[model samples]
Target: MKTSRLSTALLIAYGIAILGFLYLPLVSVGLASISKARYLSFPIRKYAFGWYEDALTSDTVRDLLVISLKVAGVVTVASMVIGFFGALAFARYNWRFRKTYQKLILLPIFFPQTVLGLALLMWFNALGVVPSWKTAIIAHLVWIAPIATLVVSIRAFSFDAALEEAARDMGANQWQTLREVTIPLLMPGVTSAGLFAFLLSWGNFPLSLFSTGADSTLPEWLFAKMVSGYSPLVPTVGMLTVATSAVLVFGGLILAWAIRRLRPES
Candidate 1:
């Protein structure tokens, strides 16, 4: 009994240590954001919101934030729409070469971000299109859309095909059944997928680094600032990104849970 108790305590301590190792950087950045000093350091002498205030007051920061929002918004909408349609086709139907195509879906998820970014940069350049925010959106769409498809497809598979057949047997047309029955049932999954898309796009760094040629994104801007010098605003802006991602991811989880409650899988 004593040996078992000691082993359990050791496991708990190990888990906490691992968690702390992963989150310590974020905690440090949060502390730095509220530090009285300009540079990032531990055991900050005083706490203040001056860095956050300064970041908010900067016109450059504001513009970059706007660009990031716009890009993320566009990417979110586009990815969700594409993902939904792709899920419908892939999840609901099977045909020749479907297996081959399914394998292709996993490629983006497994591909190295830096390599993908560079490849996209080369593709755009070859077409004589300069790297711009639009290209970044396009690049992000490739990855996030697939993720959305995977998320929505899980729900799609859970959806009973019998309902649509029943609707047809009752003389309902395809479009009418889709509009009335399909969409309503799928709304929660679609919404949660969209939130994931937004979060992924908003926090993207490597692909944005390559595709956002002249236009600046928050990640790129933050990188530039960090390269120039160490300042509290760096951590402040990072904390903002962390907070936004946390809110969105958490909201998505809640939405997914509510969906399961409303439509429990049989």
Candidate 2:
């Protein structure tokens, strides 16, 4: 009883500490965003929607949103294709270096983003190429694909082999079995993986910052906004970003719930 009570207290204390650490700065920035003062001043003078209006009207922010969306979309598509096949191979095949292969594939997740970004930046420079959205998309795909692969492979392991074998034993070909049986079962995992990849690509700062040109992702644009000056509209952008992420994550939850509830219970 004593240990359990102590553990509960520690957990509650940790949660409170983490919440304060995460949200206090955001609260400060949010307050500054609404301030009527020319500069970011704490204990704000007056509140207005001027900053929000400015952010909405800014072409830079608009373009960056488009670029980030495009990059994320491309990364999702690429990760889906790559991860699907990688998962299938891992799930189906018995081959040499299987353990090594799994570790190698997951290596990207262990890599520090700063180091990965710097390495890619140097490689681009060595290749005598200017950093662009194309490069950013490619860099993002490297990291995103591994995560997608891991998600799908784990889910694939849970897949009922009999269904696939029965499909194959019948008239169904390899492709047909995969399409009809394997894919439907794996849909949830794919959705989860795609959502993860999209979020990763969308929010990636170091990689996007180094690889982007005029067409940069949202995080890169946010960095520029921070360095140039703290415009009152900045928090508006932050709020919108937070809202967008919330919607996506919530939508994904709804989807997962729908899938589960609608699925036939064994």
Identify the candidate with maximal TM-score. Answer: 1
**Model 1 lDDT per residue over 1-266, tens place:** 35688899999999999999999888888888999987777789999998788888988778888999999999999877887877777687777877777788879999999999999999999999988898999999988999998888887888898888898899999899998778877676688789989988998899999999999888888898899977888888888888878887887788678767877473
**What is the model-wide C-alpha lDDT for candidate 2?**
0.83
For candidate 1, the C-alpha RMSD (Å) to the true structure equals 3.1
lDDT of 2 at 203: 78
Q: C-alpha displacement of 159 in model 1, angstroms?
A: 2.1
What TM-score, computed on C-alpha atoms, does each candidate reach? 0.89, 0.87
Residue pairs clashing in model 2 are none
Mind giving the per-residue lDDT tens digits that candidate 2 earns over 141-186? 8788999998889888998889989999998998899898988888
Top lDDT prediction, candidate number:
1
Which whole-number lDDT from 0 to 100 does residue 57 have in model 2?
A: 87
Give stretches of model 2 more than 4 Å off. Answer: 1-14, 126-129, 264-266
